[model samples]
Target: MDTIKKYLESMFEHLPKTLEVMRAKDELYSMMEDKYNELISEGKKENEAIGIVISEFGNLDELAEGLGLSKVLDDLVSSDRRYVSRQEADDYVDAVVSRRFMLSLGILLCILSPAGPILLDSIATATGLNLFTGIGVAFLFLCAAVGVGFIVFSNYITKSWSFLNKQPCYIDDETIDYLKSEKEECQTGNGMLLAVGIMLCIVSVIPVIVLDAALNVPIISDGVGPSMMFTLAAVGVFLIVFSSGRNKAYKKLLSLNKKVFAREILQQFADAPDNGPEKSVKIERVTGEVVESDYKDASYSSYDKPEQSSDSTEKKVKNFIKVMVKDYWKSVLCIYIIWSFFTFSWGSSWVIWPLAAILRKPIEQYFLGGKH
Candidate 1:
């Protein structure tokens, strides 16, 4: 009997609580309950009785089809599912604004890390004056350290908002309207930023190629060109990242929108009714008695989210690094080896790793969501 009620609840879970729908649900429950009792009286086991009743009633979709509520059910499914409120949406967008800037700054620093050492080395080679040995090495390591700090800090600050990535929820029309405007502004309003960013990236290495070929001084051309190239590319990427803040927020919202309601790993699991205050679960506690019920008359509700308590911000950063490497390890390795060989500055080549991490999501999303 409990099994039958639970199954019935799940079937109507996403449906609207209209009079017609409620009437249909009550009638179906009555018939199923009668059938189950009849089967039990005939000596059918409890499990066998449940199986028979469920099979006889069939699924909700099949039943709703005759009443022309199939389309209604399909559309209303998301209405009852988890939804994001306006406040939550605003908080997310604001967080992304800061996060994107920090993330871009971190990547920029990483790109500029090798630039310092390369430029210094080039100047030293071109000049007759000798500087302290290992000065360039110290500067290289310093920039790398600062870059790592920014990246890690960005990851830390955004850790609380990571739920927008993995958890699925719906949003009301109002929130949708709000997000649409923000997203459009990000994509269309900042057209110049996007274009300039791409232009900078495309022409970033042009200085190296042009200067290396045109300049008679090999030390100046080869050394200084790479340092300048990284600076230009880093600034370009920073603009791209910063400009896409709202765009990222909107995408995150859509990804979390459970459009087609179905079983998901993080879907709600408690045996809660979709209607009727009287149908709420209640638990009566008896002293020295075992509490066996999964739910009581009144139960608290929340989506199944990852355990965030006691989790350090670095956890996500490390996980992203792993994912970044897993998806783009070969490409990063090839770039590192080739660039190191080309410039003969292995220390400066370390910049590529952070750059790969910063750009992984966009590149992956582009290919994954690209039109075939």
Candidate 2:
């Protein structure tokens, strides 16, 4: 039944959120539900019934045009099964804005990185001060710190917004199409920006070369090289930051995250529903008292031994370990090797093993929604 709802939601995702569209979706859900119930009554298994219903009623183009949402039919036909809600759209926009601001600040700092060194050199030349003084070294460190800080802070800001990686609660077709279009457009823009940035970086050094050879300006020649290099680095940083932000935004809209919905339909073991009425089971307590408790129908029988439960648990743990290694063994190996190379700290490197244990659930959930 939940599968039916998810399918209907995916079909209607591209449509406008209008009253007419809502009416169409409701009518469609009712129709699918009726078909599902009829199939179930015929003794068909639940999975087979769902498959039949979906195949029969999955086409939605004509329904969309009839509902006056023909404008989105092209997208519906082309889009994969993905959806996003209005709130999610708004949240993505907010995240992009915040990320853009941090990236811009980082780029500005990179651009200014050479200024301190150039200014200090100019002051030394003018005042006849020694260039290798303690003050000069301190100024150099300050400029380097600014550049490093900008890079680190920008990365931190971007990582802080990683919560957006979670699957959205609701999604629709229109949202999916919009994101696809935006991703395409952003990719094109990034390419253009990269070309322009490369051209500017190449041209930046021309001024210094021309000043030294064609005009013989020693002061300007000395300062321009550092300035040009800083400018080039800034351009590279900007391109990286801007392109990454766009990619993240598009990924969110695409719902690349795995999502799972599980529904348990309890079937009565008795031949007649009335004979079972409200099902209950009897359990003998350690105190030797027999108690009756409601028991939902499940595949496992009440007569199963306790060892069966233990075996199931053991199998799940083995599966979890297998998946963890399959997904992250390379990363774990790299971390260990890098730590060992720099600090020769094999003992501390072992900490990553425990860290992997802590992260196991999240990594599994990311790829499999925590299902084995």
Candidate 3:
């Protein structure tokens, strides 16, 4: 039955994708199916048959040694890496997916929340009455409540993964290798996403601008401009957040190791954009202008020059950025909430996120430059 298949999948989800392990999984499934069929033929109820089948074969720990998984299990248990169970993986992954959507949907809801108010305001402007304006304020509060609910629930659900910050995640080496390939096949390719997402966001305000400015439509300022801006910008944000979340989740899973995770964080500072400045310092010959960079201009001629950073300084910088990145997102959350409530100018307000994302790189580079 489908239930047995799902259970089987979940049970093996954390196991290595070794040929021996995979063969064992298939053989076990076939055996269980046969037993299930026998029970059904003997007038056993469907639930009863499933229960018996699971009870007989579902104890993975008891059967692991016989299935030639003793060595794998022993290695995982003895190593410094944490051995993840099927249930743990499921919970963590669910947390990742749910939390991502929570953020995405929350932003979308907040951006669109003003639409009703704007519409009501437009009606009030047309009718010259205060009734619709009052109703619009109430509607805005309702929408804001729903948006906050989404964000809070997402924050709560993501608690399952919060402990990952304190420790490294470790799974089987064989499983890690398998996951590498799986990730390649399914990765969201953020390069394209970044380009497309940023482009969409940059252009999201065009509708409002075109309507109000180029078209010389006074009605646009009354309400339609902001409503359209929210709808469009929210879609762009939804595309980015909803699309990129899976890739981020997979990366989190892979970087459960501290070294790998640290490298990932540090690399953000190391990598230069194709059109961005070089990593090493360069001097402009004609202008005699000094161009500072992430790394010092090291050469045989500069033997007397002190090195870029001492080990202590480098480690401190690393910790600083790690904390900064974490806090940066929290700051962003606060900015989103506060500015959204005060401005109520959805057209201008929704643009903050797109602009904030653009600012993230420079802020990181600044800290990397020892300006922290």
Candidate 4:
């Protein structure tokens, strides 16, 4: 019975949320329930009953046309569909954890970056060599290369976890429910992270002020104060990165589930011609490959009006822009804040806009693809 319900839900998941569709779904559910009960009463086994019920009513194209959702089906079939399996979900989680660890390591390296110059200077001075010469500069570059190597290696490892790139990865109901719950938890975690991060940033300056006034020791006054602040800032950044990574992972799972459900329904009715002969198609089951029928001469243009098309286009463009901004807004904000702090000019911070525009696509593709 649960499997029957889940199958029906998947079939209707891609349909539009219209009142008519909703009513039709309810009717279909009731019909299936009745049929299942009848089959059981007639001495059929539970599995056999479920199979019969689903096979009888699982043609989504027929359901869609009956429920006045032919247009919705058409649009859904045209869009790309994605799928994820239980193994892929586990792999995705591992990849996210690995990436987060790498990010933390990168952050640690950055915080210790000043040590590179200081270490080289100390070594040169101890060896009676000039500390401000070519050797020191070369060592500094070597330190930089090491940091870059860590970043490059992290990226390579992340790309090697290519389960996400494979389409129609199989998944079960338990995985879907787990991912949905995880997504909710991630949202709550993000909120808590923001609150804690802001609190840390604010409290960071307080220690410097209090310690400087209370203690007169040079180490405490000069060194410890700034170091404490840097530590707090680093912690705040860590929280934000952790929260963002988890949130992105959960979102990716949820998005994949939705796409996969839609694709499954599309495939179920792939050869049906209720939408017209042009929309009749075949999908390769093993590869989950879709071969769409050419609809060049299809008279289904009545489903899409010029005004509706324009509005949809505009909405899609807006959504793309919004996603792009959401993905990189933190980096952009950080750049602006850093520039403003150094130059003390908010106007000059505007330079980040053009830089963001130029780098946003590539950065998203390489750095944020997992999240998307």
Winning candidate number (TM-score): 3
Worst 10 residues of 1 by lDDT: 283-292
lDDT of 4 by residue, 1-372 (tens): 899888987876545445767888898899899999999999999999999998988887777676667876786677454345567786787788677656645443433333334444545555667753355456445644564455455656667556554664334456778887877866877789757855665576666688889997655655556556655654655555555666666666666554454455565454355555434433323223222211212333454546465558777886666665553544454555467558845223333433453465566655444334
Which has the higher lDDT value, candidate number 1 or candidate number 3?
Answer: 3
Q: Give per-residue CA lDDT, model 1, range 178-215, as digits (tens).
A: 78887777676557776787778778878888998888
**Candidate 3's residue-wise lDDT over 1-372, tens digit each?**
888887887677655555877988898899889999999999999999999999998988888877777776675466454555445655666677778788778767766777778878887888899898999888877877787678767767776566665544555444456557756865646556666777778776677777777665445665787677777777677667666566666666665543332332333434534222332222222112222221234222354556665558878878866776655545665677788768754557777766666676577556544222
lDDT of 2 by residue, 157-271 (tens): 5564454444323355556667778778777777776566445544554655676676544446555554554555456435534544565566655643222111101112222
- C-alpha RMSD by candidate, in order: 17.8, 17.3, 12.6, 11.5
- What's model 4's TM-score? 0.49
Task: State each model's CA lDDT, in order.
Answer: 0.64, 0.54, 0.66, 0.59
- Each prediction's TM-score versus the true structure: 0.53, 0.44, 0.56, 0.49
Candidates 2 and 3 compared by lDDT, better number? 3
Best by lDDT: 3
Q: In model 3, which residue pairs have backbone atoms overlapping below 3 Å?
A: 169-256
Off by over 4 Å in 1: 1-83, 165-168, 189-191, 213-219, 259-372
